[model samples]
Target: MPSSAPVAAYPTSTRPVSIPGRKPRTQGLRNMELAFLVFAYVIVLAALLQVQLGVMGEFDFQLITVFGFLVALTVAMHLVLRFRAPQADPFLLPIATAINGLGISMIYRLDLVNPDITDGSVPNATAQMVFTGLGIGVGIAVLIALRNHRILQRYTYIFGAVSLVLLVLPLVPGLGVSEANARVWISVGPFNFQPGEIAKITLAIFFAGYLVTARESLSVVSRKFLGLRLPRMRDLGPILIVWAFCMGVLVFQRDLGTSLLYFGLFLVMIFVATGRLSWVLIGLALFVAGGTVAALNMEYVRKRIEGWINPFDPDFYEASGGSYQLVQGLFGMSNGGLVGTGLGQGRPDITPLAESDFIISALGEELGLAGLFAILAMYFILVSRALRIGHLGGDDFGRLLATGLGFVIGLQVFIVVGGVTRVIPLTGLTTPFLAAGGSSLVANWIIIALLLRLSDTIPNQATTRLEVTT
Candidate 1:
């Protein structure tokens, strides 16, 4: 004999329930990231081995041992992301690591030929290794501390103020240091830092945050001008102010590259924010007008323009601040042809600034066009993923921030690579992670961390929606 409670009958039909703003756990994202990291490390180790065999005619076990520590740090970063940001983009870290490793190998090759590089200062390769480690550490810290990407919006004006101070720091007496005709670095004790590198990051945050609230006003349409809807005269203050700021950077700091990068970044973000083609057109006209004026009035600007026009001119080639470096880089790349001169076999050392401004050329000389294309492809993938993250984001601020950061890297690459290849006049901007500068390394790595954070937080519609069975 059994006493039974009435059985609760389940519904036969099932329906999907909508849950807005609900986040679901992502699967296998960390595993994919780990796989890519391992592949990146393998590439780094192979490149280092080839560099050693080519430069030293033998392997150096001591250097490899030291590099193991850097690898360990990267592994630690991967583990941190596994725990903190499991949904982050997988390609960012591995791509950066591979490029950084190649840079280290190239720098090491340069170090082998230049014995005087270590006189009273750290060797370029060693310093770069240290910077890479520090950059990775900074990235890890960013991921650990910054739990949400939206938190940055709170400090938009503060970031703006900080960027302005950074831009102006190079003008301060005793603390300011001028190098390579640009007054954009500050000297503190024995270290010289380029604040503008970090300023770009801050400025991006400011632009994104400012635009989030101001896009509607800035997007107001007036009369049609040249078949495009233009903004009202009253609403033009922001663009004008930004244009003026860029001109100031050009005139005072003599840094045309930084000015262009900052302006282009703002222009891209504003266009994305407002969905206005007229703003881009207006921004372009303003920049062109400004560049034309600077070229007419500034001797250095004129020289750079003239150099870009005719680098092979005998007089310009032999001039003090002319196209010698440009021509040498071209010649070296020509010597490299389709497939590079093979690591240490080429005389890339003959080119000045090979380790810094012209690292792309140095890479072209050794790795050939194929290798350069491959590296560029990696950059493309990295930037495209960032833009994708922006596209997938549910919030306006996160979308704008991701887009701004992506443009920062893309524009900087175009500026550097274009200048090197004579597509544009050269300006003093580092090649992101590949160039030998601690400030740039740290700033770019922090950018990677921000992108990772944003990726993790982007709402996945597929993952969030669930079915209920009755």
Candidate 2:
């Protein structure tokens, strides 16, 4: 069914012409992604097999079947991206998959130690697998439904309102469910969801859209302080409002992690939009003052600081609401040493909330410092790619959004990992893709979809410019 025709293009005028035989570079990029995904999945499968062998002393087909289903879902997502977002960043999905896979395997390993687990009570690993599929499905839905990230800019305030509502929903008396000293959850039938997780994304969107329009005013220099150009006092309204809101969350909601995350996200995005270092300094000062006051006044907050400062103290270690969990997590990581005890060899489950809040320590106890480094390296690559997307983006909104997204992930990793390593006071922030919270997983996958969409537009925007010139 071949027609005899010229494969080459000839330009008769000053306009550039497309060749009939030419292929878009996006196809090549997608091919590279496919190859990378293959390698990533192979590593995941190998890890799962090692866990099975180490824990059960025999290969179990159940986890393998779950892994197969996960692979199918991810492959389906990859295919969708091929047609929908071929020019998207290739590394995001693979890195997310590898981290999520490791989390699932570790959770499964921990489940093996639970002899009391019954068929009626679904294991954490199985629940995590189901949630992973749901997250991917939501991601695909986002890609299909949200064709352009710019459309979100149209409803900036609407998103801001939604974020506020979501943030306060956990504080509603009848609906709120407090756990682990923080009121950050709400029960929906059989599940407890953290609305703040989704709120983080919405807040990022709001910050990006608002900053794109307000950056000019925000950039107005009032005076110099400490050799830094500061914004006008009037411009300080925005940061002050956000800072107060964050402090309110800390005081009322009793959730330090979410409060810090929201403030940090806004500060980073605003600073990026205005190219202002003074904003960073001022924001840091405001948060430090707020935290200090809270630490001095609040009992729970004071105890957390004390726990971080001296977890081994006999008085604090043996108290009812003491440093027992933190100390145990440290001991577990100490057991890991240079290299891990291997996947299933270490007693990671001995640490409280090993598969959730203290996942990094659990992973460290089994995978060692080297394995942790490898994981952190993947996180570094992922965050760097997001920042690169922001830098290369053609539009202001895209740039700010991408930057905010990168900071959200980067700051979260820093907080969680720093807390685990005793470098900072611990807070309840899930490790993006590697934690066992369905709300966090769904929100993060949606973030990936947004990043993919933004990256896809970079090439399309370039082609549009070229076409306009031609």
- For candidate 2, the per-residue lDDT at 425 reads 91
Instruction: For candidate 1, give the lDDT of residue 336.
Output: 92
Q: Where does model 2 exceed 4 Å of error?
A: 1-23, 459-470
lDDT of 1 by residue, 1-470 (tens): 77686655876688877566654444356677788888988888888888888888999888787569768988898899878888888889889888888898898889888868756778888899888888889999999999988899999999999999999999998889855488988999988899998899999999999999998999889899778999999999999999999999999999999999999999999999999999999999999999999999999799999998999999899999899999999999988999998998888999999999999999999999999999899999999999998899878999999999988998999999999999999997999889899999999999999999999887762344568876
| Candidate 2 lDDT (Cα, 0 to 1) | 0.89
Error of 2 at 391 (Å): 0.4
- TM-score of candidate 1 to 2 decimals: 0.94
lDDT values of the candidates? 0.89, 0.89
Task: Candidate 1: list runs displaced more than 4 Å.
Answer: 1-27, 118-120, 461-468
Put down candidate 2 lDDT per residue, 151-216, tens digits, no spaces.
999999999999999989988876889664788899888888889999999999999999999999
In Å, residue 52's CA in model 1 sits off its true spot by 1.1
